[model samples]
Target: MLDFRHISAARRLVPVLLIALALAGTTAHAASGPGASSKGLRLAAMLGSQDAAKRAKGLSALRAWGQESLPGLLAAMEAPSAEVRRGAVMGAALQPAPALAMESLLNALGDPDATVRSLAAHTLARLGPLAATDVARLLASPTHDIRVAAALCLSRMGPDAVPALAAMMRRDDPPVQANAAWLLGGMGSDALPAAPALIHALDTDDTRLIHVIAEALDLIGPDAATVLREMTLISARGNRPFSRMGAAAAPTLVKLLSRPGTPMGQMALFTLARMGDQAKPALQDALATGTEGQRAAAALLLTGIDPNMAHTLPEDLRRTLGGAIHLN
Candidate 1:
């Protein structure tokens, strides 16, 4: 079984996935002249070809045709060949008007092939803010598969999708509620405005919901810091305490660290480690003769705070504090 305690703390230190706009738009030949029809037809046909070279050639031709191929590409999304369908979607992705291109991608979202659906989701996400309305529609779709795809796409849309996400939070479904919390955190500061909803979610007894909301609050930073601090205090006395609370609240909980001889200060240092370099100076000062637990927490914080600073800390300090301590 996963150690729920340490997992929450590590989650804050973990890096957010790299947002790769793979289909955002890539280079393609600009089509022209009477041969454009021939090129487009050839590309459409290549979408189903067994030969990889021919398929590549087909993609090249359709991309060359640009916006002119939108209608044909839309029609080709239903092609028996999954490759053709995916190729058609990719071709549309390269067009200046992806809104039109995405119609086929949206339909392709229901493709029996999981690979095709994942590709469509990734492509729509790459379209960024333009995919917002489509993603919102996906969230409301009858199929959970579509909803998941939409949620994933919106998560990648960053801050732009927060308004729509905040609206979705009103729904009582736990999956929707949980995903909304995750996406809000994935967006960072743009999600600052979502503090109230997350704070309310944190009050729920559901560990899943509370942990996710706590993570989101960290992403929202100090704007949501005080609530997390209060919750930490509440949790400290509750049946289920939140050891990771201070680490998540590190950036905004600086004042807690400034006061000497406080438990909150130790928590702040742990949180600072999660925030890395941003929490450095405070962590350095807090390291002074605290306890084995405090020093160990500082060592963990230093590992990721800043690569340069990590080198500055003496090896003896790291070795002395190498063992882990229970956060509570």
Candidate 2:
């Protein structure tokens, strides 16, 4: 019988030689003449190559082998060395159907090594909406690297992942909540549905989560207005979070420039005043497009920001704040 140590060594040499020599290599000769077991060995060895060129050659060879390379790649994932396991992960990515390899990749996402887990996540992310739930679950993993990998993957899934991420925010699990906020922010405008959740997230005592939510709001920008028209219905205990968002919360506040005495208007005035120059663009937009009262309010609010905007306001629209309302 062939020596076990030699078989392991042969598996390495076989694939490399197969790249240059093809039929001349011992493993290639073995692969060509016989049962799929021999060919599988050839495949695993090639894919497990330490060299990128050889691994790429292995991937090309895998594409040519079509579905035939799968069993061997699956078995290779169980190998003791991380290198071989990574090779198997890459090889599985070649399969046309995600279903064929998803189970294995999911298992791989839990691999002790972060690199292997990340590779699995990237592969899953390529499936678009199909892999969203699986990746979202990883946000709860004890491993920070895995959580980051999962967040980045879900961000790439577009709006398909917004619900899963928004649901994560409701759990009060700080790490998961934080990662979800970061992912939603990365999704930008597509994550608008989660804006209210992100807005309410400021109730957290966790400073890290608070900062993350703020940053996400900044990235989501004007879309924070999704909650604007309904702002009267939300609790008014604090406007700190809205003000914390810098310019991003401006659009929502601009809506309130017309209604002076209302709770929402008071909150908007205080928050917009605090934003200074950051609130300039939205106020300028309002000046250009708002109703007469809105343009008047925007001009009055802008007086604190731009001395000339007050000059641009018609004498009637330039009137001061109403006595009935007080800035919060």
How well does each candidate superpose onto the true structure, as a TM-score? 0.53, 0.57
TM-score of 2: 0.57
Those runs of model 2 whose alpha carbons end farther than 4 Å from true positions after fitting are 1-42, 51-57, 158-160, 203-207, 229-328
Top TM-score model: 2
For every model shown, the clashing-pair count is 3, 0
In candidate 1, what are the lDDT values of residues 1-328, reduced to their tens digit?
A: 1112332232232111111112222355543335544444445566445565655555555556657877766776777777666556655665678777777787777787654565566667677767676676566676766666566567656677777677666566555667777778777788876666665454443546555665665666733365555546533444546554433333234433333243334445445555566456546654664345545555556665544555555566755644532121
In the predicted model 1, the residue pairs found to clash are: 247-271, 276-305, 277-305
lDDT of each: 0.57, 0.65
lDDT of 2 by residue, 1-328 (tens): 1112322343344334334423322222122426554555556666667665565566666767777777777877777778777667766775767558877887787787655665676677677667777778888987665665576557556798888888788887887888788888877878888877876665555656756766676677644245453243233436543333555557656765566665445657877887789889889898888767667677777877766555565555544543422333
Q: Give the TM-score of candidate 1.
A: 0.53
